[model samples]
Target: MAKLFGNLELVLIVGLVAALAIIGAFASSVVVDANSILRWLHLFFGVLWIGLLYYFNFVQVPTMPAIPAEQKGAVTGFIAPKALFYFRWAALLTVVTGLGIAQVNGYLHTAMSFTGEGAVNLIGTGMWIALVMAFNVWFIIWPNQKKALGIVETTPEQKAAAGPRAMIASRLNTLLSLPMLYCMVSANLG
Candidate 1:
């Protein structure tokens, strides 16, 4: 049991197989289609991105100063870099899958251009918000994070400038995630 739970890849594989089996069994109620697959991928990676974002904002960042100076290496050296890798990739994939979903549903242009009525307009709002957040993740947050976490060598002054920039960008994403999620959910339904 411990061994099974210890490996994330193994756990995810087993979970995927199990879910496929169950969904297969209940195929009458659930239709597996391209749009659905895209939605699943979008949801999965969105969770990963947002989960890591929260972890950074709520857990790692706040606790960094509290960690013993000598012990800071454990986080800055090992944990944060790896977490950031997943965080950024997840953000990328989420955007990709979301765009795929929109394209498949034949609303990509209308939703993004905001030239349509009803749900397209609503979803456009969410899409734009997500695009902004993704931009922050890749462009602003990531570069600043590299300096702040010492992934990139910098002078003390530059590094000092980076930390708060990264944090504020991260917090901005956190604030946007709430309404972004709401817009995504409510767009089609409402």
Candidate 2:
């Protein structure tokens, strides 16, 4: 049990199997479909991406200045890089799965165009905001983070410049996540 729990892959596989089993058992009662699965995937990836964003903002960024110079490498050299890998990929996958959900549900055009009334408009707003956030994650944040974290060859001045650029982009996403989440959740209520 300890070994199984200790390994992330095993734990995730077991969890997925358990979820599939439950869904299969309830198949007669529940209407399982592509849109449902895509929603679940989108939710999972969105949580991962936003959770990391909050962690970086609410925890890591604030704590970094306090960490002793000698101990900073532990975070910058190891923890940060791994976190960023998951952060960027989760951001990408979240957007992809969300778009899949919209497409599967036959609202892709209406939502993208912001032409539908009520829920469609709400979800469209959320989708647009999420797209912007994802763009920042991939185009702005990841590239700057790579340099800031020394994952790529860069001058000392470039690295210094990259850190703040990544931070600002991340902060922008954090700011946008609030309304985006509200739109996403509220749109489904009715």
Candidate 3:
């Protein structure tokens, strides 16, 4: 059991297989809802992305100063880079799945127009905000982080400059996440 759990890929595969089996067993006929599936994916990836974002901002950043200088390598050298890979990909997946859900549900245009009443307007605003956040994750944060994390060849001064830039961008995304979530939930549900 310990070994099974230790292998992440194996664990995920088993979990997914079990979930599918359960679903198959309960239903008379299998029918998939595209929008619902995409929504689920969007929610899953969004949580991953935001959770990592929060981890970086709330936990890692604050605690870094407390970590002994030599011990910091455990994080900067290993953990952060791994986490950021997932973080950025999760951000991309979240946006793709979210937009796919919107498009499938016939709200893509209405929600993206940035001018509408009720759900359309609310969702549109959220969509736009999320898009911007995702943009930051890809275009701004990731590039800067490559330098900041020493994943790229850069001068010490340039790396120093990049770290703060990436941090600021990440913080901005964190700030935006709250209202974006509210709009996403409130738009259709509220």
* Residue-wise C-alpha lDDT for candidate 2, range 1-190, written one tens digit per residue: 8999899999999999998999999999988899778888988999999999999999999999999999999999999999999999999999999889888888888988989999999999999999999999999999999999889999999999999999999999999999999999988821
TM-score of candidate 1 on Cα atoms, chains taken together:
0.95
Which clashing pairs does model 3 show?
none
Q: Give candidate 2 misplaced runs (Cα > 4 Å).
A: none
lDDT of 1 by residue, 70-141 (tens): 999999889999999999999999999998998888889989999988878888999999999999999999
Compared with the true structure, all predictions reach lDDT values of 0.92, 0.93, 0.89
TM-score of each: 0.95, 0.97, 0.93
Ranking by TM-score: 2, 1, 3
Model 3: per-residue Cα lDDT at residue 119: 80
lDDT by residue for model 3 (73-186), tens: 899999999999999999999999988988887878877986667888888989999999999999999999899888999999999999889989999999999999999889
Candidate 3 Cα misplacement greater than 4 A, ranges: 26-31
Q: How well does candidate 2 match the true structure, expressed as C-alpha RMSD?
A: 1.2
**Residue 14 in candidate 3, Cα distance off native in Å:** 1.7
Off by over 4 Å in 1: none
Best by TM-score: 2
Clashes of each: 0, 0, 0
